[model samples]
Target: MAALLGPVITPEGPLTGQLAGDPFHPDTKHAAKALAQVVEALLRAVIGWLYRLALLWVMVDIVSFPHDDRPAALT
Candidate 1:
């Protein structure tokens, strides 16, 4: 995906052809880097929430189980 959008985002790419600017423009690179950081942070938060929810479910299951010393009588 990056390979395909890399050119389109760069200064010399078709998207910015009218500007006729350098391909390695600083502003463009900075924008992409910032976007990546935001995405990474969001993903980390989602994964952490999911992990906590799963842990809570396991704990509830463990607490709800009966701990009996005697076996059940025949029905």
Candidate 2:
């Protein structure tokens, strides 16, 4: 694999055109790690947003509909 594609170095990393090999293979570990991190961050952000949105809805409901606290005969 490495022998076939030869050594090709790029700004990102070195590539041998193979996923996994003995001494020559495309260095995709960094890219894969970075992508995973990004996906995790995005997921966390979305979850946080949803939580906040739900909280906002609860607050709005409470504010819009106030509970009446008075004696039944004191209307």
What are the per-residue Cα lDDT tens digits for candidate 1 across 1-75? Answer: 645555465444555543435546676677779999999999999999999999999999999987675666732
lDDT of each: 0.74, 0.75
**lDDT winner among the candidates?**
2
Q: Please give me the total number of clashing residue pairs in predicted model 1.
A: 0
In model 1, where do residues sit more than 4 Å from their true spots? 1-23
- Global CA lDDT computed for model 2: 0.75
- Give the clash total for candidate 2: 0
Worst 10 residues of 2 by lDDT: 19-28
Model 2: residue 20 alpha-carbon error in angstroms: 8.2
Best by TM-score: 1
lDDT measured at residue 20 in model 2 versus the true structure, 0 to 100: 43
Question: In candidate 2, what are the lDDT values of residues 1-75, reduced to their tens digit?
Answer: 657777777776674446344333334566677789999999999999999999999999999895888888999
Q: Model 1 lDDT vs. the true structure?
A: 0.74
